[model samples]
Target chain A: MTARRPYAGLIVAEVISDAADDALVLAAGMTGRILADLGADVVRRRGRDRGFERSTELFLSRGKTMSNESTGELLGRADVALVDGAVLRERGRAGLPSVSAVLSLFGGALAESDRPASAFTAAASAGLLAMVGDPQREPLRLGGHQEAFALGLSAYGGVAAALASARPHGVPVTIRASLLETLVWLNWKAVPLEGYDALPSRTGAAAEWQVLRCADGYAVLVYQEPDWPRLKAALAEPALDEPRFATRGNRLDHLAELAAVIERRFLTLTRREIHALARQHRLPLGPVWSPAEAFGEPHNQARGLFEPLGVDPGVQAPRLPLVWLDQAPARQAKIAVGAA
Target chain B: MKLLEGCRVLDLGIITAGAATAALLADFGAEVIKVESPTYRDPFRAWSAQDEPDAMPPLFRATNRNKRAISIDLKRPEGQAIFLRLVRRADVVVENFRRGVMEGLGLGFARLREANPDIVLASISSQGETGPDAGHVSYGSTLEALSGLAWVTGYQGGKPEVSGRDVNYPDQIVALFAAGAIATALRSVRKGEGGSHLDLSQRDLAAFMIGDRFAAASQGEIVTRQGNAQHHYPLQDCFLATDGIWIALSVPASALPLLSDGLAVGDSDRPDGLRKAVAAATAARSAGEAVSFFVALGVPAAIVNDGNGMMADWGEAWDHALQRDEQGLIVKGFPLQVDEAPLAIERPAPQVGAQTCAVLAEIAGYSSSEIADFAAAGIIETAR
Candidate 1:
């Protein structure tokens, strides 16, 4: 039998909020658990007597190592320190000691502090301390679970980037792909030059240039003006010649009318029937598949995009961020702390 | 100084996919030289930007920060020659056209490998280059829907609501991952092992983000929508405070009493006690106050903030924000701090073809006359 090789390992100091909400705990716990799953050594320094359920270990923490040491004690030995300043203060600790890096898991005044004192030593913020809070809401607090996850992710990214640049012989770098920045970057921003602050709008289920639903499933499709004539012929919809539906513009202006026409046309046949129609016309269309549906899709299964993990029998995770090297197991269990 | 102070990247990307990857590299201190076609400028110059032809577009500026740009139309034989020359001297090349586009342009891997076998090439596309769907065209939205992310984004009782108007943002996230991967690959190449082509599909990666749910779905378990309702605890959800602020709370089952006692609400034993207590407590206090009080008690909670506020706080409190140039471009700098030295922001984003003449003259050893002739032949577009 082959011995299992751990992928990553590190200890961490985590601070929780007093009278905190459930979301924050789940967020912090889940984040730590996921890292542990990825083979990292994860220890929770719960200074204020907070306990994590073993059930969460089954579901979220997986194979991670857990502890109830003071934040100060954990910080001295940790490679990464995730601090919820609100949680630290709840224990009535005056301040937190600094470590190599501090991930501000929440926002506000503690988020405002560069240095954190805990059961560990006094942290002077020698490393790249990053602050990430969820900015989707009107006003934000620290340790909003999902937002804390966002900050933790950004912290992960910053750490990854920082390490990438540390070695003397490799391409060096510093990263700033923050969660908040990521949100802004993701947003369809208003055009700066013209003050147009929107990207496109949502038009549901109408495959203007995508898949359309049929009786059984869906078929992906595309429509350029060249394809329009072929599509009209295939659907046998003479109404396309009508003034309101003739040009792309007129049809776009009255998408509701066009959608109604297409939906009614689609309802007449099964997914196979639509696939045949689309294929014969050489339209760009595919079936609308759920992840479950995708698992069974002949094409997906054939392409080697799914890999099974032992965590769940008959459960295969999608392979992505595809690497040329042999696939490593997805970070499944927490690495043992202080283990080689 | 930034950690990547002396590193140089040769960028052959256009539009969102490849360019965004290169942009991130530039953000991290890699000197990215954006290679473009002298004849047809970056189409994003026309379509994506809010600026006129003569001005820089905000889309371009946002992503293209801290990099130099030069025009060399690889389709033209001379342009290909110049780009190959640059590749031999660069650390990486990022491109996102269809699979055969680079090969068709005559600057394919074989030709470039002849110049520098170790030069890293990152091929970003809708689907991977060798896959069946490699030829497919994808913007962000279509890619999102195809990946099953959009299928899971809506409310419990409603159809999945896609956020934002464009393709899902996972495209950029994938792009970031690709950048990180290529950078990691470059490390291998520098050790004399040679570079490897990274085949990253946006669809494949975005699917991984929702891996936990997918793991269950594979085994006949369907995870449904709950609209901010947590699976573990009932009260762990986003709530609307009286100030019209949305605050998210995550308290353990044991801390329920602490919350009840602090807010002067009924104990957790009451039928609707925890819910009513939480609502009243949050309502009576400002979002910030509620957050502060909770933090003092060692609970898990946070308030959602906006962009300006986030940037503002980083600028003011956290010393993480980079200083911008007069043009408001984030100056190039070291992203990480070492031994209390603040990361330095060195240079701002460059203009189109800003260093064409200088780079060609200094690095490529092209004389003024040859450069002028190449310029006349439309081989390289000069800076305005």
Candidate 2:
């Protein structure tokens, strides 16, 4: 039997500022998108000149209705409100719903700071950029708006908790999530560990788990200390049996040579072949795939991971990551746009 | 009131993906009891504490704080019985074991529900519970590679890059999403919905993070890595400043005129030209001057900070992402804050079986004699 959607029969007001920081807009939109996907009647308050790319707009606006309602009108009917900091400031807490999630650039002590920040700057401030890419080169931001979307995920979690705990007509709950805090949370390991002298930093090739070139493309060589013997057996390469590569510490000392030895073997095998071998040996090897390749992956197709956005047959977005084993997938609401 | 003040969670999760999820719930005020087995310790406990053999590893301490812990030999029948007794009182059970480990231990979702009808069993895994790769072994970077996130994360025209072991991106983010999903499920149960088996896959969540790339790819957009350039910005890249610091800067289309005037770059339409001009201009100025110059012109800019610099800016840029415990050690903090009831670190990480006797006696209704018998038989462990 199909179970009811977790958030069915609820209304969410999404008021995002068009001229706000790009990350804030993206984060607010993503929070609304999650609510819409989870069966909420998410009404996205339309903003003039919010020139989002077609793909971003299509992905973030899925299952959400476009409306030109005033913030007062939307909050009057909404059970929850997802807004950017700008919108939250403009519409004070007096008129908000029982639950609201506010997205901003720098939260906490600097919540009111007007510092010019985007996702990249937030990532930089959070120390996320320093954790990726080659340490010798300039720090690189993670692909896409991870900092902002992480804030969105954090906001959604806070909102869900608020909903779970809310008493009907009780004191309004406001969740403040920011790109800087979210990124810092995600990159928590970068923080200095007490009594540890070595601070965490980027280690490109020296990384225990690294992406090395394979025959067809690239595969990330990942394994714990216990998997060393199994990795040696899986690779079937005599060079890996050297004493210098025995322990994790030893391997770290000879990382470049170790990576070269593994890459040499990987270059002889395709990603598919390497993946099969990884499965056979119970190794955690990962073969990097392009988005196009991943779209048609057999496992993804079997799991029904992606679905068309309905408005455009060619465009697709992933279903909500959560899967209720006994229930049918949540039905997508038809797109509705009121007068702008 | 705390968000989950009255909730109880039995956390069988280990390592990042599982343990962090439970930790987030504990931060939200759930009474999270971390369940571990005597025969097996969380791998994170063994990470980087070689100097102090008895001390909890920093990684484990970061994620396991605010939760009580107990050790049980679930392989024993008596231990399973004791666990079921705790299950009867738990509102949720979270685990990230290999696909069949729970069923092998006779504590699968069905058994959990049989013990407590409204139990929310969150099975967080590298893959879904019942897929072809469901039983596949994986780490965080492996999921990033397989889920198409690595495909998007790289230098332009370079091979795909993983966040590596240090910042296993997939593992950290999955905890956030899973916590939210668990909270949502709890809400459903509160609405009189029966127990739910939440099949959350880290790989699937990794894919969802880059859903826009997939959307564009599906429409034949040829979504390849473009380095630091985002479509929303006319020019964006990390440039070296005169002081040997790298400044990450983004110039919106609206700021192009100011950027052109500041950098003496004529053609804002040419992203390549603007990028070069910005790089040269930043190279001529100190990082502070470059960042301030850009900020004054309504451009987003910052010095790409290393770990120490990031920590130094804790108060100004952020406040609570990392906090000091009673011992004055830095630990993981909240990603979000609630205005009414802010989350906090109420306690430090527990030793194995630290709360076994108290939880067994108070929550499981086990008498001292029964607890002693179980302890004597090696069915459970109690901290000395």
Candidate 3:
């Protein structure tokens, strides 16, 4: 038989928070979901009145069992616990498991501040809001609940490391992960580069790589220095042969004109055609596919990348993004969410 | 005590995805030795500052701190022998080269397991190690485009937008997840399981981040770009204030009454009307005043901070994500802090081959004369 999943016998407790912030709930719920996917027994404790969007609930509550056990009782039996700052403070260190990851809005010096915050506000504070979109317009937040989910990723890493080193009856450890810290960590390039006085900002039309309109939808024009020759050959337009677009520096100096020349060629081709050309030339071009359209993509279908949600057979989510080469491919047993 | 005090890792990682993962392991107290070749240094070392050869680029310094550096030309048989010797002493090896580079160098998983049966080899790539498009060339935004993230991330009815070269979202998050997977594999090794190869794909991870959208779409739900309008929030977007600063505000349904009373708008029941009223009210006051007002009333609001504004709120909003080193140079910091065994920057980034002599003598069991011979034969490099 194949070796057991990594954390098969591990038990995790996910504490619920009554606060109305979506970020906190998502972070805690996501941490539990990751451990559950790794074969851990995750028990999600529910408060009487807390509610989440149906999609969020369906994605996060997979492979988890709803529990009515008190926080203290759950901690007593759990090998690990995922909690928010408020819950951690409410229960104190005495009632926590040997390994506990505390999710908070702000950590370190501002750990106790009760300022109202959401994923949007956290993104704004972390300088992530200033990185995307048109420079002339207001900066845009990323597509989904990225800030909260990133915090969940950080917490999971810390918990995994702690679990790797934990002894049978070792001293307890508290892992602190926060929304602001996690966002900043992801956007670390926003911090001024060493020896540079000015910080990097959004480049809009000036960026070397950009999404241009195609016959169907949109496709990003992407190519590194080495792929420049192939990109020019694929487009096969005379304007690209202009002296002004001879080198990377020259092309940057006339980025808009260069984009116009390429986009003129792209507007006639569909996204699939562009993708096929990229594959042929070994270029890094990417065609933007809506979630609905992505379901039918040949690559995704071939990889079997998505799995159906247990609660609703019609719904599906991406499987865990890792594959162990040594083990046989075995589907995870789907556990339905039940009432506490 | 440090969490991973006794763990030894041979870092064959380069650039953001691989190097940053090793850096996190270093932060957790693992002994991570960064390996490069004299002819092939980490491209990040010259990413920016081509004009001044001696100056370390910010990206390189930020991702490579807290580890010692050694140079080995793995292409040569002698160099491969030395690397296998080091591998024998190491518990893990991490790399993110294009799909077949390691195999071409003859240091593939089979060879690594031959050197040490319990070694954990983490192969991080743009696609997976065994897919039809496994050899596809990609950057972070390219993966974002292919992974269905950019599709849902834009103004309503507008074209999709990437985080661009500056933010490269996939490269950053993959490091976090890859490090965790390595740790889990280490746990398995400690439990007597044999060696394993971890296949981590950035494109797959980018899709996983937006997994809920996929779930909805697979169920025949039309999951199009909704901009900043989340279903749970009545109104959420950025508005420019009188002082010329943009303020992001999110209003929950429960706060509709309070928001209507505060802004004196009778049309708060409608989402569009509430958004217009909030925009109008925000445009009449300074960003700080508007943020404070909404926050006091239990609404989520904040000023959209640029880099400088982020530095201004460093201590209060966040403290350790970006930190100052011994010489007051800014470096990458931790995403999480352990209360008992807090992570820290023990040393700054090293020069190429900075610890070659010491590592060869101490860990690889090479004597001083053998190291001298290797240097003479051009198989290894020592820091000048």
| lDDT of candidate 2 at residue A264, scale 0 to 100 | 99
Docking class of 3: acceptable
Contacts from the true interface found in each model, as a fraction, amount to 0.15, 0.70, 0.65
Candidate with best DockQ: 2
- Model 1 misses residue B274 by how many Å? 5.8
lDDT of 2: 0.85
The local distance difference test score of each candidate is 0.52, 0.85, 0.84
TM-score order of candidates, top first:
2, 3, 1
Best by lDDT: 2
Interface RMSD of each: 9.6, 4.7, 4.7
lDDT per residue (tens digit) for residues B202-260 in model 3: 98888888888888887778887777777778788888999999998878777789888
Clashing pairs in 3: none
True contacts kept of 1: 0.15
Interface RMSD of 2: 4.7
lDDT of 3 by residue, A1-340 (tens): 2333677788999985776367877887888888888889999887644345567778888899998888788877988888887777788887788788888888657777888888998888888888888778877888877888888889989988887773434478789998899998899988776566667777777777778888888998877888999999988888899999999899979988888888888999999999888988989998898888877777777777788878566788888887787532233322211100
Sort by lDDT, best first: 2, 3, 1
Clashes of 2: 0
Q: TM-scores of the models, in the given order?
A: 0.72, 0.96, 0.96
